[model samples]
Target: MKSENNYERIVQNSKKFQHSQKNEMQKRITDLLQQLTNGIHERNQIMAVSLLGAIAGHNTFLFGPPGTAKSLISRRLAYAFENPQYFEYLMNRFSTPEEVFGPVSIKALKEDRYLRKIEGYLPTADFAFLDEIWKSSPAILNNLLTIINEHIFKNGDERFNVPLKALIAASNEIPPENQGLEALYDRFIIRLLVPPIEQEENFNRLLDSKPSSDKPEISEDLKISYQELAKWREQLHKVKLSTDTLLIIKYIREELAAQFDKLSVYVSDRRWQRAAVLLKASAFCNGRKETNHSDVILLKYCLWTTPENRETVEEIVMHVIKSCGFDTDIDLAELDREKESLDKEINKELYYSQDIYDTVEMGEKKYFPVLATFKDEYYANRDKKYQLFISFNKFHSQDTFNPIDEQGNTIDNIECQFDGQGSCSLKLRGNSYHNQYTPLTFKPKIIFHKGDKKLDVNKRLIYSLSQAVSDIRKQLIDILKQVEKKYEEYQQYLQSPFATQVDIDIAVSGILDQIDKLNLRIKDCERLGSLCR
Candidate 1:
């Protein structure tokens, strides 16, 4: 069970030992985001998610046109960590490996072996940024792919582990083709589109706002240290995802394939695994033991491989989330997905146990006109004698009739068709239609009286399923309330004067929309549950 005051308890404990440690993680993160995006508005999502990704030790890519603060934001993130060895580089196709890794070692060259000097460069940086990252030559990109992924710098015959923490890469646009850059592109897990300000008010603010104070140099007192981050990064593995979140993920993957061409949006197995880590990191940093519905939103940043696929991925994720109720768990989503199959299975079972008797008379010798007997006699014997009308009373108890064929089998081939009035047409499947017989006159016999036990069983099963659905619905309602409360808190914090550096309307809107979707899903669930009856 999760403690209601987990966040407070954790913060209070951390404060006792070191107040700045736990408290400063979020504070410094928000501060850096604000400072870097001061004049910017409506892009709080990029800043917030980017900060989370950095905290989780995942690299980020900011793609947009020039003057969108990509470089500024990347630089501010480096400073957010205390005393980081920050490295910034602008790469081009002509760029040589020495420029990024380091100049060829003068001492190593004397020994007739190839090597790069490793000091005050990308090889030693705790935080680094590469502008126009895809523009780098293949040699630089290949070396970068290894360094960024494994933190190892290879020079000559020696391999040294680098001290890098997180690397931020900026791009004006994604590379048009893989061209051997697929591996490098995949390394930057958190890809974001840094579109220019959308709202007019934000644009006006950008024009009138003063340039941020000189980008602060790396300062140990203000930065989040590797030790501090390592503590939570390890905790990320323990963060659990609720069943609803998993179902939503599964549904998105399925929907993406069904609705869009596979080539347009392809997510690799490795990327999904890493993306889960990012989600876990988000929940852990938020003081939760398990991920909630809101954490699923982080996937919007992870799944999109290109700007073209970004909006579609977001819509897919959000739509899945909206279709699930706030209280939706793995069990509930499973039930929703398997509803049709469940109904079919239940109905099939009920069919086997279905009542076989047609009449209500019980424990009494009651005679009923055999439908097959009446039809056979009426067709075979009626041709000998014709009548305008025949009363059904003679075919009842007073008459001795054979309801079985000469083969000693019960007449089971009897079938009837009602024609509006208190009358019906009875005929055997193999029997030829007689022009003289307009409609058969006979009372249905009580072959054997039996209760509709299968019907009762079906009702019971449906009722039980309905109850389960109702329980899940109720849980979802409660969960919805919790999400709403959290959203309100975020809004209040955003509205506070001290924290009014950026607008999170878009972020908050996405969250609110998710909440609304939960409600819609809950309603759908209710309707589905009621269907069991």
Candidate 2:
């Protein structure tokens, strides 16, 4: 008894924790995001997502027309960290590497050595931003790829690990095709299209409001320190990818493959690996030990290569995530088949094998034949010989139906109505028998269950069916409870600074729909079990 009481207490405690769980990390992140995006119009998602990329230690690329506050976003992102070394530059075709990387060292050059001063330049910065990045020469772009990928800078013959955290690059257009920039372009995993203010109210608000500050005053407590970031990165590796997340990834990959001819989208394995890291970091920051479906939604911002395919890729990802709800190991199809089989077994054991309707055989066709009596005094002694048959579908219907003869031909001028009891009435009408047929009641032979031998129907069979139904119902109820718990946990995602409410709704709607289907199956099981009782 003590052990049982202890088990009950454990279960109760588990339920309590599930309901009251709060993600302190997510709340802090949300507060930081609000501070970062203060006074920004229609750019909250972009700012929040770019900050997420920075926290995840990944590069971000913003693509749009000029004057869309792309540079301002990167500048504000630097304030999220303590004493961030921020660097900004605008690139053009005529620009040289010295302007971006820093001027050459005069003393080193005098000694016949080639070295560039790396202070106050891209090499030493913790966060960097480049505007019109596509116009940069191959030399600058190539070096940037190394810094973004490996955080390494080569000055003269020595290699030093750069302190760069995340580089935010922006351009009005994509890099030219076949320009040897694909490798560098792929380094920036978080790609976003920074369109102009879309809504009229937002556009008006943008025109009416003052320009947002280049560096918002963030609280010191909210600003992440290098030590905290390093520790979080270490913890991020411990975050596991849930099975539902992996299934979502697999489905998206397969769908992209199937549509490759139409979509022309190809994601390299390296990019996928980086994307997984971003998801893990997301879950870690959101106070989750494992990546869930909400984190998987962030893949839409990571997988697309160009603005043209961005919407398509997002649709595909959303489709997969919405279709894959909480992964419960219950096979509803198999359960349905089990219920149907048991129902058939019960009917076979208890009900008659032959047709319930009284049928007469005529050339391999069986039908019910009835008679009609004349009501007219002129034809009172005359009884009409009419062949009558009830349709297979009319057993439960009250509608009048035409009678068919042994040859399966409709006997005109006669109508039959089944009362849904055991009896039916007929009406006759013809030139000779007009208004002359009395309604005749015919009782079809009743077919009952094997009443006398019901005891011999293997009590084990009925008991087994009942037990199966009970087990199925219990399993379904358990799965439903799990789904409810998952939903409750998902409520925490509403506070997420990265994912949108629309996407969360799509995922939750799909899960609820699946739960509804499971409930219907449970009802079917109950009905099936009743057949035996």
Candidate 3:
């Protein structure tokens, strides 16, 4: 966020020199953070936005490990606001409220009313940071509570209200034993988990950025005005919330609730509220009246607060949030069932058809006892004309042919033709080459033809498939709309049980089954139709 192109910083410097409205504000910060880590579990860039909004007022808590960019990135980001008023405190047992709020003003003591005079410190300045906030005792946290909320430092019994535009606090961990940690932690709406730099370059940057004594300065009026901060707040309220979006949010909450019992984790309401704030903050930055789909680019902080909860939040967004209004369990189940059935059908065909031609060759054969003989229409011709007639493959050839004695002497005259009679010819090699055929037989076309309906059915099926695909796309769109609208709501569950992930394994299995069965059926239909033709 600390780039040379920071127009916000330029405007602030301009205000110091009182320049004309150049409209030369550069792009907002967080470009790299967004580009490199766009939606890694949906934690919004709160520090960046809050830092921008709160030149008049902003506070944050970056919690995680020691090497996480807690103080490093936050301090750098704070510099863009008001030439950077950096007030850092490594909180410890000895840390006093005055160390953060600033010592009581010696000059104000002369006045009748007691007020802490700030020559130069946190009390008079704007941007501040507190490192290892929870390492300090409850007394310190208690002292900070009033200062953080009221923007005033209390001395003895008197309080001095100061202009605190922003504060970036940090903790090594979200400790369970810390008695007052939760309340103190809640003050930081922009709660981010900073991790050790994964990229070697960022780590190098951190090591190279050693503490420097150089100071940057500008006139007092260059500081951000309360009016502008108020405008941001006002502008946030005007953002719209669509009904479809609300439905998506509700669905996400329901999903979270359903899985809470299983995961043994809960997403608190406070986190949801904080997510809403972040959503608005992002909307404010984009110059949008309200958040749209594209704004989710970095606003995931509203959803997740810890590294562990990031997966859960991500599932809600990438799967559930992305797949809104769609539950394909039935389609999947049916497809699976069809696949099983088709497998069995194919397996049943593995056995080849037993020879039935020999059994039927006997005169007037009744065919094999096991094989069912059904009446099938066969081609037969009356003089120069073809007519369909029921023929039996089960005739008893023994009765139709002349009886033969035990000596194997045949009495019937049989005709054998070669080459459909090469126009009607026969061989007479047996019986001393004297026997031959005389009558000629004709063959008829055996095509089973009817009105062609395949084209119509194919067209209908294509239309239906297209319609189904359209329905699927519409459902997906509706879901995305809901997610876009309830982005804050979706984020709320990211770290909570309500933000549970869809069973990827199950979903993938089901989808694969559907595709496989659909392909199989399509293949079978085409094959059968071809064979029949």
Model 3: lDDT to the true structure:
0.46
Which prediction has more favorable lDDT, 2 or 3? 2
Query: Candidate 1 lDDT (Cα, whole model)?
Result: 0.64
Over 410-496, each residue of candidate 1 has an lDDT whose tens digit, in order, gives 444444443444344554444445433433555443333342224445566667766766766777677677777765443322221
167-224, model 2: which lDDT tens digit per residue?
9999988888999999999998999889998999989988898988998989888999
Q: Give the TM-score of each candidate.
A: 0.62, 0.75, 0.50
**Collision pairs in model 1:** 81-223, 82-223, 243-330, 322-517, 327-476
Report every candidate's CA lDDT: 0.64, 0.81, 0.46
Error of 2 at 490 (Å): 4.9
Q: Positional deviation of 499 in candidate 1, in angstroms?
A: 16
Worst 10 residues of 3 by lDDT: 382-391
The clash numbers for all candidates, in the given order, read: 5, 0, 27
Model number with the top TM-score = 2
State the lDDT of candidate 3 residue by residue for 277-376, as single tens digits.
5555555554445543323322244455455675676566445434332233234345445544533433233222232222222344222211111121
Clashes in candidate 1: how many? 5
The parts of candidate 3 lying over 4 Å away from their true place are 1-58, 67-69, 83-85, 104-121, 150-153, 156-161, 201-226, 242-248, 261-270, 296-299, 305-307, 325-533
- Per-residue error at 352 for model 1, in Å? 24
